[model samples]
Target: IMAVPGPSLFTLRDTSQKVVRYHHNRLVASPQTANAPPGGLQISVVPNQFMDPSHFPIIMGINGGTRCLSCGTSAQPTLMLEVSTHHWGVRPRAF
Candidate 1:
């Protein structure tokens, strides 16, 4: 099996330079092959705290594979974020 680069851990800090939360991130490979009908890669981000229940563990799709056009091994991953007012508050909120 090829050695794929896994996910990395990240944190978020407030204006005061205080770490407000952290992300326990991971990449899950599906049972099927990467070149299947649809992409079999998924990215999950579980926050340490101050997350809405509905969005606590955020899961998103990823284009899976190890092949590259110019480079031999393209092992980089991408993450997209969509921030909104509902994601922040004076206190943590529940779903």
Candidate 2:
């Protein structure tokens, strides 16, 4: 999984190399991947909310090739976010 952060929210690229997004309380494939398959793949949904703010390292998202929010203990979490790219037709904000 690869995550590219934006202004407020971020876009998730799944193993299928398709962008994934959270909408209406569920995780769905984003139609942003060029020359990709239809509907991408059905990914297991996870709560798209932040953990305890006190967590030593909590990765909310990454911005402009910089670590926006710090996270930790993700050795093998059910869902993972990772990647780098400027999407939505806007340049990423400098950290």
Candidate 3:
């Protein structure tokens, strides 16, 4: 649920900022801050102004626990997460 600047969020860029690969709906990147743990899938979402800020970036553990990740303040627009659930309609978690 991290917020990125625009539709170019998943456009994998090289060190020179050249487009490496465009990943539709998903991305893999390291966090910009040191407080966060590494490695997780980053899926794109449509912008939703009605969403609660606290609900952004919902984090889950492999043990099935749920949590949240805060990416700090950003002037860039962000996407809202409706839910990350299983086919059975239950939300999922990760380790």
TM-score of each: 0.21, 0.30, 0.21
Tell me how candidate 1 scores on lDDT. Answer: 0.32
Give candidate 2 regions above 4 Å deviation: 1-10, 33-56, 61-71, 78-95
Better of 1 and 2 by lDDT: 2
lDDT of 3 by residue, 1-95 (tens): 44556421222334644332213533334433455433333323333323345644322122122322212124674533344344566544322
Name the runs in model 1 displaced over 4 angstroms.
1-39, 51-88
lDDT by residue for model 1 (1-95), tens: 12225533333334554432212443323333344434222323323233344433333222332211111112454334433234555543222
Colliding pairs, model 3: 60-94, 61-94, 61-95, 62-94, 62-95
Candidate 2 residue pairs in clash (backbone atoms < 3 Å): 2-82, 3-82, 57-71, 58-70, 58-71, 59-71
Query: By lDDT, highest first, what's the ranking?
Result: 2, 3, 1
Global lDDT of each candidate: 0.32, 0.42, 0.35
